[model samples]
Target: MGAMDVVLVHGIFDNGAVFRRLADALADAGHRCWVPALKPADGRTGIEDLVAKLHAYIDRHLGSDAEVALVGFRMGCIVSRYYLQMRDGVRRTKALNVATGPDPEVGDAPKPTLSTSGC
Candidate 1:
């Protein structure tokens, strides 16, 4: 595919700096990458709050109409999922790449089906 707008999300206990190398590589490859540092990385503020912050970040930086590819690591995967499933993100998300650890929120839950054919 051509150059895409990509958002890289860091895990709990980490910040956007963690994706510096990956962002550099993606940028060098002509992709527009945004690595946002979600505050309260410890997650004491809750995942929904983090998702809200992510939503605002995307709105501010990428606009609501831009199609984006999401890359999430560890706890960020969970945040990304919430954004996709509950925040209308599937409408504008071109792809999702999740590198996640064990997630209690997903354990034993039915898998969600996301339609991206029109994205």
Candidate 2:
């Protein structure tokens, strides 16, 4: 497949730097990658705020009509979900890959998995 746009969202207490390796690999594979640092990574600012930031970032950098695949880690999964489900992001999202972390309900995190749904 031709190069596709991919946005990597880091986990809590982390920044875009955390995706350096993955971004490099994706770049080598001919995919365009964008790792945006969501501030207040601790989530004190709330997921909705982060989602809004994510939406604005995508719109500014990739444009509102561009299609993208989202890779979210830890708390980023929550933010991504909000963006996709609550913000009408599913319309432009090509895929959703999640790297889960500790969960209060599950008691333990599940293995990392990539979940994708057609837009």
Q: Compose the digit string of candidate 2's lDDT tens values, residues 1-119.
A: 46789999889999998899999999999899998889989999888889999999999999999999998899888788778877788888878877874453563333323356421
Which portions of model 2 miss their true places by more than 4 Å?
A: 101-119
lDDT of 1 by residue, 6-90 (tens): 9998999999998999889999999999988899999999888999999999999999899898888998877887888778888
10 residues in a row with least lDDT, candidate 2: 104-113
Alpha-carbon local distance difference test for all models? 0.83, 0.82
Per-residue error for 60 in candidate 1, Å, reads 0.6
